[model samples]
Target: MILASLLRPLRSFRCVLLFSILIRIGLIIYSEWHDSRSVVKYTDIDYRVFSDAAHFLLNPGPENENVAQGPLKSLLGWKISLGNPYTRETYRYTPLLALLVSPNDWSHPSFGKYLFALCDIVNGILIYKLLVNVILPSSSHNAASQPPNKTEKHASGPQHKRDELSRTEIEALATTFSAIHLLNPMVFSISTRGSSESVLSLFVLMTLYASLTKRWDAAAIMLGVSTHWKIYPVVYGVACVSALSGGSVGSTSWHLSLVNQKTIRFALLSAFTFGILNVVCFLIWGHPFLEETYLYHLHRLDHRHNFSPYFYFTYLTYPPLVKQPLDSESLSSWNQLMRSPLTSFVPQMTLALGAGLYYGHRIDDLPFAWFVQTVVFVNFNKVCTSQYFLWYLLLLPLILPRFHVSRRQAFTYVGVWIALQAFWLGEAYRLEFLGEDVFLSLWMRGLVYVLGNCWVLVELMKAYS
Candidate 1:
């Protein structure tokens, strides 16, 4: 019995998941050691930022009375705290994240790293469920990219109807998805670097899973939690609402039906959940809650050493000029251009909204639709980071099985992504680390990044269409 159990196919998933998790843990330890020794290690400043936040969370100190006075006072206190070496950080993440990391007792960085690694494990399990329940079940054998086996064809008979996946096939697909997620290079890099994107990824996956299962109330709360953590998931909420209400696909135009009972309940539940969380945070942390978390992002603009396509445009127009940092005053012209209604923000928002509407039209395979919508959303985002790639990369395995692709297209896609990333990294290394900012090279790098995304978007449109 023991031997038979060990040889079982289902057990393969267990073995794979365990191995993947072990590898991630090893990577986290390796990264910590690497960062300690090397100035140009893989870890970003985010690790330090989060550490500072985590430290502040445990030791908010006697500063609370001052912080509670007003947003201005709170900002001033935070600014003052920054100058002090001992207790010098304000929390920018949601309280839930602070609470999640608080159990480590502000003891060591390992606690947070371990917590993130554990979240990756949970994400692996969630990916497995997403594939089994949503992706596998919804696919028709005829519609699958691969041709059906002889047994499958026989089962369907002369009428040639599609056959459901067998239990064995379903388990295999689930295990495959779980492995891809757990062993993903991007996921490993993010988790090892102690980035909170892992936590965000978990809530986002839960939101997708809950929505796909028709658990509207749960979906709403999860969406609320995710959005409160990082603002981008709010874009997903639009897709969530549309998926719940259902959409008309065949036509060119699409509309959201707010009158639908499901949509109404989802909206109210989500708003209440999100509002309550923020209100509780306000009562406890006061004005600083909004100031540090949400408002900070509104004012935040990173024109230097970023991968955004718009970065080079601002650089060319504003010209940070040879190691001299571009001040806020200098960027005012670029900012004005970006904020203009006819340019920048409006077009990106319109494209994202249109993509969401297009994806929502599907009633049977909403998960795949949701994945496509997320890809579109991230691709067009105002700011694109390597870490942000995790958002849709995690979802691709679930969606890829549904589409048929030729070798040429696949090669083109992978080549485009890698080539673009490689070029950007090479230039970024020179500009950031080597202190060589060849002004023209920066423009070329940004153009390559933009073109790479455009190439990717075109491929996605071809595949999904």
Candidate 2:
């Protein structure tokens, strides 16, 4: 009878594995189909910008006009003036990212797209591992806490616990989450488009996983590598520091114990190793590469339509803001108008530091720390894009395991996002009347932007209290 019972589960497992493989195959087919067409083109402003950087990297030029673009181009190889018909005069925004896009035969546009898709696949795998091995462990513990059934009781005790998850059961759960990550529309869209979000997310997940295992050195190195990719990852470092400190505000046992000599030593060592690695990378790559990746992003004043609260308010009061096209010269004026007193460059830094210190004091509870830091970072940023949504998406599952919300509520939240995504696509595509009606499109996009983040803030407040 026991053999029959086990055989039934094995059959179910094989069925699930077959189903998963089919779904993955379907997704790959869809991705390839989408890549073949230029059916949707949104000016390709960012793509053109990055492509120019790639060109400059492959061919270095005089510093007179090129110096202002930033130092990242040097990393691609000493710039040569390849006076090719394809070379257009434009500045590259992201040099390191551009390097990845550059290929020996600069003719193929799909090279970078394929590379990003691969990163996206890797990201899905990492997230699956994190969920199954780390986050789901807590969920399983909660499940085990419930009273066992009569059959379970008969076979209960430590032996039953061991049987609860065989190697196959564990692998199934991992595979399920991995499939979910890959199918997620957000992941699929970004991966095929050559955006930096997939790469940044992979690094963030690695850093989080390392922290969860209490491997300070590995976590710190991951954090540094993430920042090297994009500045936004730095906010996660604050989250990590806060997590290392333990719980919300208070003098708990975890907080009290953090002051020990051994803890302090590990913390300092991690920080030193992270700092040195970043510094060395910056020096080897040169200041221009570091500046393009880190500093140039700081000076970006491009207010070319985003879905943040600032965009919504500006559109509501001054509809002209949406109509005005962005230009290099007008950037300074736009920055001056949209800039907030509290979130000024200096004040924002202060707030980040303050939040870091407060969270660091209570480091034992990393999830809560990550939640708070994500809230602060998103709320304070000047512009919020659809891709930025992944930051919250990645962190939400981690936080969800620690807190309980009704299944209905979870579904409702996800449903709202799906509706918003529809609106976002309509706006991006400028579909029919929707595209012509600039105010309506802007409002729809802006609403999604605000509500999505508002939900996160509400969740964070609950976690804090």
Candidate 3:
């Protein structure tokens, strides 16, 4: 029975992977011709930095003991610039990313796209596996990603078995999820653009999948790697620790629960992995690794081309009153503190923690909780961008069937969300390119978009029981 069950999924995965690969290859080839003919290229400029960083690491001028396989020079502080790290020439992300892309051949510049494209495909497979392993055994089939209840797990009657998804139903759900992810235009193009968002999605889902299977050590490793790659996934730490405790939050005080042995085990392992990575890289790259990767993102201030509702407000407080560490001293004056862009982070974190606690308190709730958490995090962040949406987009497929909304309602909500973004894009185009004074108008649109997002969230909550 086990062998048959396993083979069925393997066959299903192979079919979907082949189809996804063909579609991506076609789009990538078309992009090569299409990009060259247009004013704007389909390949993002960020791709240049990723590819170049790889080649730079392959050979860094003989600084470390003349080691021939000398990627040790990759750690030199002077090799990459942290000042104005925003440019395509300078690498602003993790050293691990450089190593990941180091094997790509510069002879074929699109190699990074191909590499990220594979990550996108593998993410789809992980989504399928996640659905199959996690199940609310007694709930309706629509609730695809949740652990079986204790009663359901112990039950031996035919009714208990009947509640479980059959091979056919599970296969159907897997197909739908894989198709949703691989075929989504935004998700597809993210890889083609060569943004590492797909890679991030891979690690994030791997962590979630590992946790769902109760693979604590593996989950901790993946969570650590994901967090190190980009700091945002650290927020999911709350959800993970809570889920691992198995609704133990009620039996123990909050502090005690946080200090629970399970929590400590996961935390220490994850932190150790994170620390070892930084320490090894810091030895070579020096302080810039810490400053550029972590610090810069914490207080990042970019008002232009921003979609956050705080965009106009941040613009008003553009040049910060003072450049200082994020300490109580910097927040001494109410006037300065209230006006700072970082003030928006208060609500961003509050909503994220609230969502994480309410929804991520149990294994059954983790999948949807993660989706909600990511959406809330991205929506209210001081710096919001389209690419950030992919954080949730990867998990969006898992909980899609759990919602009870009609097709019409789903279309209405999605259409409104897309329409609001389109409206903002039009206003931004006029302000940036047409050089119109549309700041106030853009702010108004942004406010309405924020309200629209709220409405969608409320409707989703109501429909997802």
Candidate 4:
């Protein structure tokens, strides 16, 4: 009776949250069973990488001794034999994963699946809070034009409307976030599939929540940690600094004083926190650590299972090359350009810089602008993994509610995006699993992905502009 009374406040969502948890638990059990039986484990590649690193850290050998020295040693013409700790293998994740999993019996296959599921739950709850608090309130201004009852009449001014979400609004917002994060099949598939994207998404949500609450130092610190987990969150650091500056949201007027002492203080703290962790990693594992964790990502361009828009370029130039193994040393100079570090680096930088500057200037609405900037950053990323979709998916509840779109328009927009994803995945399935040499179709799918992203961006502009 007491539990029922307490859950009555959450109303329908109490059941929803419980059901979501059950669904995730079921998925985890199924995945564990599948892993035990299947000869070719699907998500085993990434899980093995993390678990191997953890085991290595827990039990080092003579092979781990030849840690590479600084690049300056090579520049100074010193004979430095960089040990291939992971000669045919690579652990591209940060040491934080190794640290977290090493002590917790990560040797077991179920540990990662369980950890990811827990993080997925955390993400759902965080998204719910963000919606009920930050986003719904910012959107209430449009509703403010309507007549408020006696209760709302006594309500505080526009800035503080966030403090007063009605029961119905709260229920609706809770339902939306819970349904999106908890009930979405994509979330289930990713978590059960043993992707660490769930953990990354949780940190991203926490960082967003802190920024929304104007906890500058807290937001900065979280962003730094999240970036350490995965390099992509570094892009959101710009949004963090912008939010801390505390200018009016959605405004074009730029403030020279925006770059003030408080901003600098927070920025420095964030940098120090971020730099210290990476430095410690270097000290512990030496140059090989940095190379695998950081450099490997920049250099990775797999034509085999690549779903990036750049794949189209590779297809057009060398259709046959898609089937070849990833022997970087054997590639010709022109073929190397197809997977060149410069190719992805320059464009990603340009887009991120432009988006950061544009949205950073307009601070009429920090949360919304942050969402736009984040989506823009991901849209422009060189390597768009399917799982990376969660980075923006978790934020959509906040943005979509605020967007003044018609029901039909919203449905159409979502349908188009899903269709694009489905088309790409279908092609990928044919090639990767069925052994179909549908290289040309894969190129078409990449083009469709690009177009779909462009459409989404256009709609975002319409909503904000």
Candidate 5:
């Protein structure tokens, strides 16, 4: 009778939890609807590029614009605007995303944004599932072993036999973790926009999940699709190599290991598949796709102190040479300087890759996929904006189950990120007090950006080390 009474309340509590989750999902859907109707405004420069690419895809362009700038751009153009031609300087590198969202043009931009936002919500759910299914399993097992009641203890049995987790525990942990990801302000902000990052993140997480399950074929396909969306996902292949090489069978050292035959085969297959696709794109579109999509990244020089330590070197050593506003006749010099790598403060991207490889060996264990990805990303030569937090966020639940920072520390880190976002979003409270000095505002904002990313990097280094 006593046990039955206790079980009744527990069952009621579970029911309430399920109800709350359903309510939250409903709220998220409603919020997305409200946000979508808010506006069709560009929050960043990349938005313009993506929007232009969408237009180009739906309407063919002249020879200048018709030439493929990237695989995605070419693919989207072929899909949306088969015969007609259009021309614009605002061509983008990511046309696949535009293609995916193109079907919704009949509705307002809000509808498209809402669709993407829902995708983000789905991504958050997947992250939570990974945390429960992949990361928190061991923790849940541990928790299950220590029972509070005699009946619970008897039911669980000895510690040696307590490897499996209960469904309830798994669901609870998943729900908690999922909520964290769902409410993440950065994710919310980006998903509400029509950019590809949210979709890219979803694919990346799916790849990680597939890889964790040792479903190499599925993992490879997911990764291939992910890379098609954003080039950065290609680095994940290197991480896969590192993971498979860490075992005892073939080579003792990661540098020389070729242990797992299955993993090796899968990696090779993925590489071949992506390579073939690239070749096909090349054959279809030729040089424009190669130059504008692939090579364009090589020359991008954003004037901001991004997360990489290299940004500090560029900002401090060689400031960007801005030309005074002038007539069109004098524009050639400006363009020449902008295109010159010698004048630009390019970071040593190669060195960063080498360094990441070195450190990754020290930190990554068993399923080294996420660890290797995080290490490589942190060391990349280019700027690491706030949205790139998704890279780390996806991996954290996988790699850091045993690790626990204090609640205070977690809150402090979140607070810093919020402050940094405020500055980046041009909502700096300090700016309100400081008035119209552009230099002061820039300096203050830049400092916050540098510090926030640096703090994250430092935390990552410590965690991995």
Candidate 6:
């Protein structure tokens, strides 16, 4: 009864949403104040790009406006030139993003920031729903099938009823889900800085929620729209389709049939929706939309701020005319496994597809499936940035409660993760800011960071699955 009393108020989502709003208001004020005092503003550059694109679209000017420029060339033998398609880092997403934030130009400057914060809160609310509708139900089903405990065998009334979670406990867990997403440092900072990831995250969860509830069309359309908005979520369509085609946990198995009606329908509808969006964008933005938004990302090569395991290779293979902070004669002795750019694509796709098929085979594990798939995709990606981490972080909390890791084990993994990151950042700082030749050292640290990530992934699999 004491525990129940403590949890009762937490179940009130209305109160939770109110608290989130108040916190966002405070964050907005704090961010604006901080930016006013700083040399560089706290607002993300993407926000500026979005505003510029909107201004250009709303009222055409006689001059040419260059948004982003990609002059990167291939590292080794392949002369993969991105050829100054964009002049600077401008709006590189769908024109609809500019449309969403265009109101900021005429209205308040922080209009888009407010929109993203609201979406962040909505992402929290969706996680709460996912916990209630999908995760908790599976836990309860598993509990019911197991043998009863001493409390269940000896007690009367509610205690003996399947030994399931009470309404109060479920509500508390849902509120916990909200807390994890809304209050997380990484997630909170990204949304407050005016990135559209919060918006993208909302659609990802919406697609999952819609699919688990057996709303096929809603799921398909949601998936399509999110993919159009940002390309990463398209990988999740595989997991959703896998979950739909498979059966319950114990009886889950793979089979092939021409008339597996549900998956076929889902696939066709999603493709149609995506194709329609592409056609519409093509008419509006011409070939530039296809080139800049989609193809640019595919052939993206970040040689300067590179973070992948292939970073050193990317750096070493730069054209001889390009100046390096330090000559890497020692580094030249190491063999290059990849002679060309885009070599990582095969391994990335293979692992991602394998994870989708394996975890999505069990409907009960769909959240885990998406989380693992995103982690693999981001880790192996050719160009990884700070924001890309949010892709998997959005799905992490849904499966966290089930992880069997003890506090000590969890802390150890977290400490190693943070330590490795600090080491990489420190080494990178020495090379970039101090004009030191720490490139080789930074590359070695980058390899260690990738190893650290793999360790965490293995631990997560053992703890949760």
* Top candidate when judged by TM-score against the true structure: 6
Q: Residue 199 in candidate 4 has what lDDT? A: 86
Candidate with the larger lDDT of 2 and 4: 4
What is candidate 3's lDDT per residue for 367-456, written digit by digit as tens? 888888888898898778888988888887777656656557788989999999998889989999999999999988888888888889
- Model 4 Cα lDDT, one tens digit per residue, 68-171: 44443445654444332343266777767765666434356568778888888887778777766666665565555455444443332232243456758665
lDDT by residue for model 5 (388-439), tens:
7676675554554443344465567668766776665573333344554344
Q: What is the TM-score of each candidate against the true structure?
A: 0.81, 0.67, 0.82, 0.80, 0.67, 0.83
Clashes of each: 0, 13, 3, 9, 7, 6
Clashing pairs in 5: 60-84, 60-85, 60-86, 61-85, 61-86, 68-289, 69-289
Question: Candidate 6: what lDDT?
Answer: 0.73
lDDT of all predictions: 0.67, 0.55, 0.73, 0.67, 0.55, 0.73
lDDT of 5: 0.55
Task: Give the C-alpha miss distance for residue 442 in model 2, angstroms.
Answer: 4.4
Evaluate model 4: give its TM-score.
0.80
* Regions of candidate 2 where Cα sits further than 4 Å from its true position: 1-51, 61-94, 104-108, 142-171, 246-248, 252-291, 312-337, 340-368, 419-452, 456-465
**Model 5 Cα shift for residue 249 (angstroms):** 13
Candidate 6 lDDT by residue in tens digits, 204-227: 888888877778899999899899
Please give the lDDT score for candidate 4: 0.67
- Evaluated at residue 66, the lDDT of candidate 5 is 54
